[model samples]
Target: MDLDRASSELNEKLSAIGGTANVAVLKSVVTQASSAIPVMPLYIAMVFKKMREEGVHEGCMEQIYRMFSQRLYKADGTAPEVDDQNRLRLDDWELRDDIQQHCRDLWPQITSENLKELTDYQEYKDEFLSLFGFGIEGIDYEADVNPNVAFDVIDI
Candidate 1:
């Protein structure tokens, strides 16, 4: 459901517990799948540069593909992601219609070599995760998770 509908439902549930209109409700978030990522800003410089120079600018899908095509593979017809981890990212399949159109529009004359460097999704996923302060280079996950800490600011 949409944000307003979810928030109203949340308020209704809170009312059942005599908790409606609590100030904390304003700060609470209903978990959502489409929250914006902060990492794209950092890559703006590179993306704009690529767009201007190579005329190859892309959003998440294309960028993921580009990552794969570049760092993850070479000229021959070999697919990796089928490695020991058995970690299969359906990034190619995840390329939505609009996104594919956007990519084609950006570089209508794309070459075979260009399309080959398609995605380093796992690496991209790691970079995306690190943006939320959860997976830093120095932090140790096993040593750290403090259960006593509440999930929200009010509880803290």
Candidate 2:
């Protein structure tokens, strides 16, 4: 009934068979866009870890390019692949059975003390920061830049 017990039971069920029932429960409980279930961060971190280790991790731009080039605009002119609900399955890599199973296996072993050891929390933090243009390669964050730069406007 308590949070910890509920989380533990969910983890047990998830790890036992990687069941969709537990995933549905997680999805229902974390309905708000800005809110998440208690274990989601850890689960995502583990998923990232496994994906990176397997060399299948991709950035947002790469995913979009793949979607357009390989799926949406294929040279063969065949119809794009879609799921049962008629949505494009662009997340096929992320939803691979091996990746899901890996995350499930790591679910029960994770704890506050072993979080960094068991998951890619650091990478997650870095990626989150990159959204605001931080941690980008070849850019000098410490360099001073003129706040105002004059640019010529072209009339259409």
Candidate 3:
């Protein structure tokens, strides 16, 4: 696929939101699946950079918080609501006041030079690595290790 054109088109759509948009570029740590794809990592990173510049970058935690806390409730504080198709309102949570406020506080302080130190991207990367038995902080990757997985049939 044309990564540049795709990325540009996505950014253009985001820009059309007029700064009132809650559009967030969802990214996670690199995984075996993503690493196997030729351009996935670079594409994700570029999209992340663009979204950051657009002040719409958000991590997984933020997305989860928005999903559960902001979208599940009814305006009358009674029954849960859903979309026209009855699907969960997952995408709208980033527009919440607290979430936006928190993002606003962090977004301006992020920079390319200090992205690792300043943003949760590093942590997300580490978490992603951990899923594949890598990138755990305080764990020695240089040492020999044993990796195993055992699943209980009934419980699992």
* Each prediction's TM-score versus the true structure: 0.24, 0.60, 0.40
Error of 3 at 143 (Å): 3.0
Model 2, span 1-156: residue lDDT tens: 354455557656776785311111111111233124566656667876887888877766677787778766799988666554334556677778999898878888888899899898877666656656788889999999999989999999
Cα-based RMSD of candidate 2: 13.3
User: So what's the TM-score on candidate 3?
Assistant: 0.40
User: How many clashes would you count in candidate 1?
Assistant: 8
Note each model's CA RMSD in angstroms. 20.0, 13.3, 12.3
User: Judged by lDDT, which candidate is best?
Assistant: 2
Position 111, candidate 3: lDDT: 73
Error of 3 at 91 (Å): 5.3
Q: How does model 1 score by TM-score?
A: 0.24
Clashing pairs in 2: none
